[model samples]
Target: MQTNMFKRLKRTTRTALGFACLLIGIVFILLPGPAVIFIPLGLALLSLEYDWAKVWLKKSQKYFRQAAVKADQALHWFGKKLRN
Candidate 1:
């Protein structure tokens, strides 16, 4: 029916957009753009329709969290050193 056709169209559009963002993110990785943002955004969008993207998105989230913790620690340590 029309509903099924609409669903298919929506899925196709989402997939195309997700892949476009993902590819742009990959390119940005080497060109000094916002790869970090776009990559997760793409994964998030793709995850809405794909299990594989969901897995990868989870892993990326974990890695970003760890990186944030490390960066925060480094900043605190640096601030303490400056005070001494």
Candidate 2:
């Protein structure tokens, strides 16, 4: 019984925090803040209790990875151009 209560409390806390982060992230999209960081963080927290969040989190991870690769390539190209 104690464990069940603890689990419920934990889930509720997680859900509240997840929603808070997601909402903040959305707000950051319109305003000036770190949406990239918060969105993924919210998704990660929500993913602990929700399947949809998990799916979105995976997609976000892939997109970020691709963006990172492209950014790295661009920097490499810029460095090479400077040398020449």
Question: Could you tell me the TM-score of candidate 2?
Answer: 0.83
Task: Please list the C-alpha lDDT of all candidates, in the order they appear.
Answer: 0.95, 0.95
* Stretches > 4 Å off in candidate 2: none
In model 1, how large is the Cα lDDT of residue 29? 87
lDDT of 1: 0.95
Question: Model 2 clash pairs?
Answer: none
Candidate 1 residues 12-79, lDDT tens each? 99999999999999999899999989899999989999999999999989998999999999999999
Worst 10 residues of 2 by lDDT: 14-23
| C-alpha RMSD in Å of predicted model 2 compared with the true structure | 1.6
Candidate 1 stretches greater than 4 Å from native: none
